[model samples]
Target: MMGQFDKNALPVAIIGGGPVGLAAAAHLIKKGEKFIVLEAGESVGSSILEWGHVQMFSPWQYNIDQAAKELLENAGWTSPDEEALPTGRELVEKYLLPLSNLPEIKEQIMLQAKVVRVAKKAHDKLKTGKRDTVPFQLYVEANGDTTVIEAKAVIDSSGTWTNPNPMLSNGIWTNAERQLHNEIHYGIPNVVQLENRYQNKTTLVIGSGHSAINALLGLATLQQKYSDTKIYWVLRKKQIHEVYGGQENDGLAARGELGIRIQQLVESGRINILTPFHINGVYPTNDKITVVGELNGEEFTIGDIDEMVVSTGFRPDTSFLNEVRINLDSTVESIDTLAPLIDPNTLLG
Candidate 1:
């Protein structure tokens, strides 16, 4: 069911059916442009659903895209409470799901379709001849079948949830760590739902970002119910306060409250804090995990009896864009020019 689009003109290709991808579609529709959305997941916002139990710090007012809001409003969709914060599940259910079901957007989205490669239509990366005239070619796989789709333009909104950073400080993925797949968990696990796995168990949480804080906080809650639950917090920063952000001074009250809450938990001494710890390796021994690292210029080894949560954050998977000749920064792994603008170090400096 093609919209009022020219049959001869190639449609714009939008990758990832998450909020950013869908928002791009909404804007394209407003411009009377043809587009197709290719999502690798089974449904829209599939990555967000992984941490569905966790609440977002931002209110509904900032979460909704203006173009998407216009489209949904025109379709008779009722807006959620503007000032209220929503969980990841609520964002997907109340907002993303509704936007994806719109007639104009629904017909264009392809789910469970992974994009393996993207390149110029008739030219390789090295070939400059007629490159400007050629449309982009995408190799997408779905249901064990590979197909080529051509588009006038491509918008890569495929976020970083699928590609997480390694636990090792050097950013290396070792077999020893890979072998403990069952014991190690990445991102935030729903502690309440998976109580059996974490209850009365020793858990190590690595990293100092919001994701790690959220993971620790969840375990802390679980620890209250089962007094034996042990939690270890590891950070590369010399001072744990470095990760607390602006606290009360922050513009967003909800976000600032996270810093306040985590600080209080630290003061309570429920969690064992390891600062300036650089993990060198992880080993599984006797059905338990052992983490070897350097803590404050001294060798340290922490042997655990249970689960491990690595909240080291995520990176964008840009392998499919290899042949597209896009420039990215090695440090930030983002568009070279834009990396400096968004880099935290730069912003703080």
Candidate 2:
């Protein structure tokens, strides 16, 4: 039985204090609705700081939310150049941080709070009687202790940045790869800052996304300083050109420039590219990793790799929402209704 109280008095709960979560808060403020934001990191946009070195293809104008911008403007905040590209760090410094500091939002945010579970109060997944009348119970972990908070509604804007896809082509995690964690970097690495780890070394970068391209470009810069540095790129696409999105035709010039630059780099032959490669296994040999895979339908082994940057991609984590009934696409794992519109196969082709 649920306790009797004013359900309407409960505030809306927003998860993840990144851009989206903060934006939701701004919108709610505009609607005169009460809300609380729970952030897993020490501060807002903490995840963005991880890849702060990489610049985004989109500009500030496209990234800022209307409500957030309105709030910032009222608070005497100066906007960055609308057309200029901003690195992950710049995005946080110029936009996210400013928006989060607004008096209306700052006090409502709970930092270092991680939401571990969420469910309807006094009701399990199978229970439906009076469920709509009750509030949502969120189990949050922070400061080595767990606390339960109730909310009239919940917004899961927790992005997929922290949950990256595995390196194996078939999407499997093995002990061999786990043991070589020290030598393998999952996401983009700040090659310039961590020069010693990659300088004068042979590095393998997997995937054809923007992150992989960025990693290779950084390595290319290092190769200039240290002539012995070697770079290898691997992609599952049959032809390398497939990964070169719209190129010059893209609406966003910055994004198109990426395709142009990468194509030129590939033409230069400074980096080795292996396409249609399916990684079957990774093993350690003599303190180095040997990547066994099928390249062009033939079994092959790539050995003597000092480091690996796996920019494969990421997937959303919905484990906490197990008690909440929701529909997700089986393949894309996105909202059922949104899968058709956002599916990569539909958009890429």
Candidate 3:
């Protein structure tokens, strides 16, 4: 539902530089619309680089957006193997890099510009009449200076990658958890690159997803090099078998193998499994962080863990959009139609 506006007089403002934001830019350009892409990082696709070592489950054919592919193809760019699954590194280096380099897109992207606040020009949420007529004002802090920019409309594609869920079952972050920030890691870490950091340490992994499984796999590899290291996986589910999805039957070999490997690790005693567990709080012990939780409503404490990794999944940051009128599903935090099926994992956060 795009509004009719004069592109020359008031350009459309795009909020992120990731794949989705870039694809929107391609579409706007195809429609001969004037727009600006504001990226809050040093460069486009900065977030993708964080997990560059991880490979995607989807192949190249499913990864590229139609408009973006067309734009890249028209500019004499050759496509990669359509059926080959790409690692995050290869996706950024081979695809995103070339698309960003295109003159049409390159000229519109603004890096290191973070938008702090946004509202209708000279009007607050209370105002109605002529509010649509007045251009939207975006408060952007770039290079340590705050500046206001006007846009006919804004497309806030700021992704959910950066905002990770907390370890607590309630998801209400506490002071104790904040104090142990240095010990707790989120998302996938380049375990191979940080050999010294993870060597000979007991790490606790929370969640029953692919990410948690991958972290365990990485730690298992680390344990091979340094036999003293250990991995503990915690899940709130009634049964550990719930996480074993598709296995060898899955079309994606790597994904299927992930479940099989994790299953093997759990049975082989390489990774300690604690299921039907609910975390109440995270406290710091003398040498390690102590995880206080309940085992299926029975109080229990998991102590002396040197490190913790949370892979409970993602949630979008929409604090700045409070004044804007938009529809978002309360449960999934996504558009209503696309809301994910009731999470298969019984762990509620």
Candidate 4:
């Protein structure tokens, strides 16, 4: 049960400065709500900065909310073309920064301010019987100084790009090997190090989703440049084309081009594609890592691999909200009860 508070005196605090958080800020501004946005990174759109080379499949039209669009237009902000799919950097530069710059929104932001803990405040009420505004102690570290903020609400629009899912490989790849070559698992874009790692060596990429496709295409591109890298793709699915079509087609040509390239690779024998194979375990050998797997009820071992990249999806970061007791789904995604979940809404807890 939430404790009663004097509604009029509370200020809202938004956690995260991503696109969703920015949209929430715009909404709060229109509603004449007092709020502050806290971003853990040095600037707004930190997630986009991490995905510099990746382009969103959603077009500019789908990308911008009506409130954001109207605010930008009224402020004489030039919008990107609806047909162009902006790269992560472009999206940050063209849309996020400008939207945040609006007088109503920019003043409410506290950049490089990470919220470490969110706890409830206990206080006495005045003669009105309403508790003095509940203060959510937001531990913010900015410019070498730490401060606490008391806010009426909290909104969490932090996207899932911060955490990358781990690749589940058995003992085939020893812990020591993984520690030694950690760069293979890092999601750095436009990198071409596969040739150096897999020249005349067999490489296996796990997962059948977009990340797998990305790895295959990236390795293919590297092979084209180096002319000596051998790559193999392993998936639990029966066929590669079966995983092709989805909602990826919006404005970016790279997604569709990647699908086409994947098909071509399978047809041209450049990539050895394996499907319906379950990875049972892995053990490191003298010459190569032994990958034990069951293919159609028969178990076999694949050895001599240079690297494996897992492109599994990510989960939202909501562990900080556990104490606040906000209603969350089984997957831990905040339930959209009313307004945004992280910033101002946290005050309700």
- Provide TM-scores for the models: 0.96, 0.97, 0.94, 0.78
Candidate 2 colliding pairs: none
Instruction: Compare candidates 1 and 4 on TM-score and give the better one.
Output: 1
lDDT of 2 by residue, 214-313 (tens): 9999999999999999999989999999877889898999889889889989999999999999999999999778999999999999999989999999
**Residue 45, candidate 1: C-alpha displacement in angstroms:** 0.6
Determine the C-alpha RMSD for candidate 2 after optimal superposition of all C-alphas: 1.3
Which 10-residue window of candidate 3 scores lowest in summed lDDT?
Answer: 340-349
lDDT of 3 by residue, 26-47 (tens): 9999999988898898878888
Return the lDDT, model 2, position 142: 94
Residue pairs clashing in model 3 are none
The deviation in Å at residue 34 for candidate 2 is: 1.0
How far out, in Å, is residue 126 in model 4?
Answer: 25
Lowest summed lDDT across 10 adjacent residues in model 4 is found at: 123-132
Error of 3 at 286 (Å): 1.3
TM-score order of candidates, top first: 2, 1, 3, 4
TM-score of 3: 0.94
**Candidate 4 Cα errors over 4 Å, as ranges:** 1-5, 122-133, 144-146, 169-181, 186-188, 192-203, 246-257, 279-302, 331-349
